[model samples]
Target: MIDINFGSLFTVELLHSYYKDQLCPDFNILPSNQTVKTLGGHQIIARQYSNQLITGVNCNGKINPPKPFTAIETGAQFTFFMQLNNPLFFNYTNLSSATPGKIYYFTNRNNNVSNGKTFLSSKIAVYNAANTYAPGDLVSNGTGITYRAIGSSKPGNTFNLTNANHWMVVDKNQYLTEADALKWMPSISAYQFASPQASVNISVLGYDNIATTYTQSVFSKTIAFANPASSFPLDLSFLQSGKYSLTVNGIQQWIYINDELSDSKTFAVIDIFNDASPVSCNLIDGSGALINPAPHYSIYFLNRATIWKYILASKQSGNINDTANLYHFANPASVITSLTPIPLSNKALNLKLTLNNHDYSPIACADPQRLVTITKGTDTYPCSEIFLNF
Candidate 1:
């Protein structure tokens, strides 16, 4: 599907109730090929497709954890949960239009002879033998009739369809719908889309840079494409681009690194920036500050990190210990050309630099704002623009 990429401004404009503009899920546009070309403009990148996975017993019939038969259509950018074995015999509740006793062939969204060939190659394990299936959705040797992903004609999972030993096609994201996609996994990130509903074919290079100190960008959580350090979460929602604050009581205390709430990563743990009792300490900047906690920034009792991310917003009173440690990011733009004398605390952290057009502006130090960018080797990294107070 083609989409317009006016700016984050447009995405913001959409926050209001009702469909002010069409970014994704604007189904009215799916009329024909010409309609696809018209709305699926340059800005509308990627398609959201359904990638299915299964969770049955890994053995001949037992189901397992983390699931099996899991596949990700990187083009759609999500995983699927297709329990590839026979349907389970639900007493009553677990039946649907697409369920047992009803073996139906979902004709290709883009039906064609080649599409026919792809389905033939695909295979689905039927768990519930009691259910009535299609007259001939399956085909097996003399052992028994098995439900085939296809019927007749050119057989096999098409193109890269089902043709695989363990079907997980790398980092593929199908540009599809959220209801279908996020079932792939939430915080995995999902979006509605306009469509040819086909895979997006572009030479995408996902990379990132780690600056000792980073200058801020305007995006509440900027669309930082590069990868980050091992400690940060891969589902970089909080770090993306958005606005959120840390408050104690009602006053503001600190800011987070990115926009959106941070989700749990495999190795992620939240370290407290402030507390009442001082652990071994390192004083930073002019002040070894441990100020009061604003309502928004209070952590009653630091909780252990697991799959869930919970900010310590003080709900009860017992967990109050108002000692905090402060850390400042090194201002990046203030280039110290050749300071024989290091500008210490006597001088505020400041830097002077010449300005030209939009290149040399001070970074907007705001929370959830973007802080990084990725450039190819030939392209210059953007640290030189930071002008700080000396």
Candidate 2:
């Protein structure tokens, strides 16, 4: 003798009210000759299929010629699912004769077998313990709620299915009736579709060389694909021609525009040579480009040889006597070229340039904005200014 289990799970849920458009559960599904339970004067029924009693009442057991499960009273729409297993027999041909009224039904083929193989179906999506679900596969959460799989995983946690990230809700949004949904259907006598649009992929990068990192500075957008190379119409109108180091996406990279102004190797070299005027020098940018003023220019000169090295901004007129107590070199080494200028101001070989507006430049002028610094053997000089003529 063998023991056979004839029990199967079933779910019944009240979906809509008498208005059909509203989803209030003021209707009840009862057993034969069962009285409606009253609570707070207003009638309340099982709205969700998770309600055990209503679902169990809809299950008619494993009896032959299965009895009509439960009948709904009052004006309301309901949906139910029943699983017939074990020594039960159900014929799809005589389904209408057995159950009266407008009945919507489906067969549960999970336990049913044929030719030693189980039937694979997609039409009626039902989630079970035995079945494995793949991405894009539809599954019922047993509460009449259908969810589409986002990844290949066994549906175990029933609570997480309600979250949109794990599963996409399909059957939950049945708020509109069939007639209301069909209202948007277009009536077309004749029509033709245009050609489909093409799609192109793009990647934008921002980098910082100092930090050695690269990140996306601008968002990449899709465009129409073309045969030849094409560029995005971007406007960097606000930025000036200069070297800039910026962090994008937490990455550091050197950004250069106009010229290599932002290059690590780019620097301004002020070469001070032994000349007739000790202030006569050459000012070049990092790229060896000559730095010249537009029209009106002034400068500051610092005396690094002495303890007083701070420079003040001064202007040049027709004479060099604009300021008193200015340092005057008695032995002005005028044509002392082809010699390296030392950074030490105290040293005899140390040649520090002066900032000036005219040919007879100001002595010991240091421009802080230009970041001009005098370098010598193992020493550096920063200066202050005074007006002078060449």
Summarize candidate 1's per-residue lDDT along 132-240 as a digit string, tens digits.
3321122222222222211112323221224321121211111111111111122334332233222221111111112211223322222332443222222423243
Residue 340 lDDT in candidate 1: 12
- Provide the overall lDDT of each model, using Cα atoms, as 2-decimal numbers: 0.19, 0.27
- Residues 75-112, candidate 2: write the lDDT tens digits: 21222222223111111010111121111211121122
Residue 58 CA displacement from its true place in model 2, Å: 38
Runs in model 2 lying further than 4 Å from the true structure: 1-123, 155-160, 172-390
Off by over 4 Å in 1: 1-39, 42-116, 120-122, 125-184, 188-390
Question: Would you estimate the TM-scores of all the predictions?
Answer: 0.14, 0.14
lDDT of 1 at 319: 14
